[model samples]
Target: MQNQSLTIKKEKILTGDRATGQLHLGHFVGSLQQRTALQHQYEQTILVADLQGLTDNGHNPHKVSSNILNVVADYLAVGIDPQKTTICLQSAIPALSELTMYYSNLVSVARLQRNPTVKNEIAGKSFGSSIPTGFLTYPISQAADITAFKATLIPVGDDQLPMIEQTNEIVRKLNYIAQDDILVECRPLLSKVSRLPSSDGKSKMSKSMGNCILLDSSERDISKAVKSMYTDPSHLRVEDPGKVEGNVVFTYLDAFHPDAAYVHELKARYQQGGLGDGTTKKILEECLQEILKPIRERRKTFISDKSQLIEILRSGSQKSQEESNQVLNSVKNAFGLNFFQL
Candidate 1:
């Protein structure tokens, strides 16, 4: 009998953000933490998706252009080691756009319209009756991002499950048409933590709405945001029994507080009509201040050297460009489009 042993390939993680604004706690809770933890465990890439940022903000290109470095700074502040993870500017990688164009043909307009995530965003953006074609087909572009690097894992939120499904759809179709497994299907690494709602608790945290506490927010800013956090309106008086559900303060406490038992105890006391909102908010403010102070300091240092950030982006983009070019070549050959040896 022959001894048999098998080696498993490490899973590659591809995650990123649209460079619309500075990253915030919503990003911290959703993906940044996971990316940092996974960096040492697997090969990871973070794309500052400037092109995707342009999909909706085509009218004000400056907003997208200006925030690219801010986004990179946030990544550095949050413990994303550039040595372990490749952080690249999306537009610099020409292969991604080319792949997007090729992948677009495999998907349909009707299919893009049906994506629940895109539809919800379109409504939120008030793009009614005039959705930009780029905005509508961004999921295809995301497919290109994943497959271009041959990523096996994509960290996403629950709302983004449809995007992963759509990518795999493209992967299956292209593989079938090419009669080869040229592209790999990727899976979503959903965050275990729940979504972090805005401090106002009226909607999701958004930079445009100023409802988010940015990663680079000052101590005063974090404290102010925490103080204004939505708590139980019914509990007007300290003696009045407070409702924990829909109470943004306790929701954050549950998410970020160091001790679970302590948070649970506080919640019980508040529900039983003793703890005051002021006291609770004060506690949360302290917690947030402690968490954000280090991040702010680190971000400040990263921003001090503009050349360093540019170099980081240039080097990462160069590495990604080479990898993506190889994948794009394979894709073109699949379509019989590599007509010339050159």
Candidate 2:
């Protein structure tokens, strides 16, 4: 606990999402709530990673570009105050791109291919023999993002630990080659609830799949999603015993429901018998609606004025430029690339 407090006091946190879609309940549990709570304790920066979003969606660039403001709204809706957290756009940070170019040389194609995260993504995308260079070396760009900000802590999922591991690898290699400590290594802060699966029990809650209950979803949408959630298939009767372990309704309850003792009791009844899926689903639905209604309202208000949203992003990106340029200059000096005074 002392170590956690120490890290919180001293470390700057950098975390964000790809600008492909609006965030969902899964994101709320995994990181957004943590960001709102940590903003005052740490110097936090949220990057709208449009560039990274383009990695797989290059063919549909509009999808990445269109959701930038929506993602920002999701941030604000969840109580990430702009005054407390610096929210920036990745595409606007020139130093990050320059750093990515320089750092790319330090990472080998073989090494990029060896990254477990990248390998898994490649297998999932089925990019076979035609993988984009940008998609494959994404870890290098992420390394640039982390080092450029001198961010010491990154909030991410367990699956992203490999990315964090590879970031430190680049930091160590860069410092070694430069014979100076030009970059700071970052650590991953995994959420207590590491992942929230899809409502249909297919995979991780993803926007592309249309199975996630988005933070801004309408009341009807929430009800429909909850009703469709995957539960114990064999529990055809309310009197039959049900497994709470893989039950999506109970899982959501555990993550979102505030009363742990109450949720525990519900789980016990579910496992023992006499608790129907409808009852569990209704409980989860009500909990989610109560939690998300305010978020939806706030998100609606933020996105109503598009110009204001753009200004917020612009101001934060400018702030990031100043901070990132200092790190970039130190890196260039280490690499002997800073020739002109200007």
Candidate 3:
């Protein structure tokens, strides 16, 4: 119903979650925060990628389905305006899947296997010789997702740079073969903060690992998680000098705390041997609570009105469908796949 224009002068961004679970603090620090700031500056389209989630979650349809609204609520809670950012469900846009099928031919199996992001993920899942076909091909689907919206910017973690490179490769291949600029290329908008380590000091914060602080976590939950967060393992005494690097609590503070000067002072005190782990943890907890309280309250409001949340997603998907149809039609015409075209 909105002005879902197929042509716009402003640059566009397309990004979203996999609808695998509730978003966490890591997501906020890494991408969501950046997205909120960029929405007004760019024509943004945020997607709840249910079909891509199925690459790994195919057997768990209910998990993906249920988490779609949960992800939408998290987006709204973090200030992703439905009026400014088109938040849509991936499965609802049929054009993306069709684009993926065509784009798949533009890339080769060896190239897909060589993608660093894919290799690391497959290694983590330990799929061994039986990696699902969909899991292997999800990057092509991602390429389709970006090109379908003509998105020129993608907010991604450092590890995902290869995915964008792969997308552009397909774009070049398509245009060269068609002898027309039928597909647009996209670049990665890298996150400013490096990956946030898990509270338990793992290199990554993951839902499957059960080490994340959910965006909607209660104050009590936040406190409990922060108290148990990993610190200098060898700092056996309160007066002992502690290492600040790789200290998960300090890392979180650096990522989320608003007062840079204060955090810097805390880090210096922490390394100078007077700051106790409990004291630093308390500061980190307070800072996190201050940031998350508003988000939690906002999430509660959206979650209570499921129909409204669904309607927002439905409307966004309709607008996205209209826009994607334009790109899909162009692709079909370029490839001579549009049998109806004279």
TM-score of each: 0.97, 0.96, 0.96
Candidate 1 regions with alpha-carbon error over 4 angstroms: 1-8
Candidate 1 global TM-score: 0.97
Compute the lDDT of residue 221 as modeled in candidate 1: 85
Q: Candidate 3: lDDT over CA atoms?
A: 0.92
lDDT of 1: 0.93
Q: Model 1: per-residue lDDT, tens digit, 1-342?
A: 443422545689999999999999999988999999999888899999999999989999999999999999999999999999999999999999999999999998999999999999999999879989999999999999999999999999999999999999999999998999999999989997648999889998887777899998888888889988899989999999999999999989988889999999999999999899999999999888899999999999999988999999999999999999999998898888999964
- Per-candidate RMSD, Å: 2.5, 3.2, 3.0
Model 1 residue 109 CA deviation (Å) reads: 0.6
Lowest summed lDDT across 10 adjacent residues in model 3 is found at 1-10
TM-score of 2: 0.96
Predictions in order: lDDT: 0.93, 0.92, 0.92
Local lDDT at 306 for model 3: 98
Error of 3 at 332 (Å): 1.2
Candidate 2 at 253: error in angstroms? 0.6
- Please write out the lDDT profile of model 2 over residues 115-229, one tens digit for every residue: 9999998998899999998899889999998988999999998889999999999899889978988788899888988889898877989877767889999999999999999
Q: By TM-score, is 1 or 2 better?
A: 1
